[model samples]
Target: MADGLNDQRTVRVADLLSDFRTLQYYIAAAPTEPSHSDDYYCEGWAALRQCSIDGQHILNCAAETRVPRVRGGPDEQAKTELQQVMLDSFSRRHEAQKIYLRQAAAQRWVEWRDSILCGGRPHSGNASQLASCDAQLRIDLAAITDDSIYSDMRSSDYQMGRWTLEDPRLRDVQRWVRARQ
Candidate 1:
């Protein structure tokens, strides 16, 4: 424990740092194998990163003061809510996808609205990745549009069709907006 930090606070901070390191390792390995394509690994990485940051914030704020207690920790309502969210996240199918789609939609919608409304120009980054995915997208669409008997439909359609900006800065902006919300 650091100087005046209690055992609980010390343990929490250590646990958080350990979790953060684990995430960093996974992120490093994400491009290696089958894990690269797993949504669980990708989403888990994001969640762990956010959690690590939150933990760091907690430690920083409590550095000079005492740690705050979590009131009524893990009540029945909280447990039920956790289970419900877990179920919803998987069953809803588009919960995470919607965030990406909504972001893409809102950006394009805004630019189009702005251009027509105020004679402004659209951002160059808009739909940048769309070009790279063009061939695959066309094939996917063709497969879907064909007759059911002749169609090669196998599983759920993963065609999260949409536009996306390639600018790295847009991610920061998106994360910032999400944090504020």
Candidate 2:
């Protein structure tokens, strides 16, 4: 039981890292031209960095908890405490991501609105539509975070850490934005 618990904790920490990597990829691939402001990119970058830092902390916490000296017995309290920490970290990261996403979505909307309102395009997937799409994506992402699927995945047995800026999931988001253009 102890071995299983340790393994689960390790894997959960790894999954958090994976999520962070995906976020990094998404932020890096974000459209700077559409945003038209360094401040926007800076905010996104900061959020990604925060996610990475949180993931590292969660990994360290998992390692510490797995060590015999830190948690010697098969105490449910220890496991529960660790789980709460993981969840709290995830929640904080998700909240930060939400703020970034919202800002990005708003920027995209403004770009589209300007294009349409200025007669640049005749209602052929302009900023308003892009804004709507971004809003929907934010809603979907919020729902997923509320479901806490990532947190549950961490409790599994898979050491899936070391995220990079090339996750397919983030690519899909980029594609969605381009599809509007």
Candidate 3:
């Protein structure tokens, strides 16, 4: 949110920190399963999104109901101290929430690695085809990176005489794929 020394995006530092946690939620969810799902990751995706919504809701509610600012007075002094205590309490809760989300995300990532590396099909379609050369190639290139390229090839567009495998783009991609192997 900060731009050099100013708030470039006009976003508060607290908001930026919260957004970072939301990203963390997504990363953690990957291990839980389905961050690599076909067409859609389903469960992991939904959970991460829900985590983001929940976090945002918490932040927004806190902001919306912020304690009144203290100015000056013996009475105001006591109010200010109370506000400080509440703020500290909220900070602790926020930190706890962040920790929970981070741990959840890390656990999911480890699970995804275990499933993919140890012969479990966590996601269908290409994710399940990780063991085969041809399948992996298609998964990484056409399916994962370029849906149109994969679909066109699957629908016999190459046989239409307009998109030959010998084309430079396809050839280079094929070469790159082979090189990785």
Best prediction by lDDT: 2
lDDT of 2 at 177: 27
**TM-score for each candidate, following the candidate numbering:** 0.20, 0.37, 0.32
Q: For candidate 1, write residues 1-181 as lDDT tens digits.
A: 1223233333433433443344344333322221223323332234334434433332233111223334545443343343333222221222122222222333343334334434433245533433333333334334332123112111222232211111113233334324333
Provide the lowest-lDDT 10-residue window in model 2. Answer: 162-171
Q: Rank the candidates by TM-score, best first.
A: 2, 3, 1
Index of the highest-TM-score prediction: 2
Q: Write the per-residue lDDT of candidate 2 for residues 93-117, one digit (tens) a residue.
A: 4433543454455445445445445
> Taking the tens digit of each residue's C-alpha lDDT, what string does model 3 give over 127-169?
5433353233223323223334434433453354332222224
Which runs in model 3 stand beyond 4 Å of their true positions?
1-41, 62-72, 75-81, 84-99, 102-106, 109-181
- Which candidate model has the greater TM-score, 1 or 3? 3
Model 1 deviation from native, Cα RMSD in Å? 19.0
Which pairs clash inside model 1? none
Order of quality (lDDT): 2, 3, 1
Off by over 4 Å in 2: 1-3, 32-89, 107-111, 118-181
lDDT of each: 0.31, 0.44, 0.40
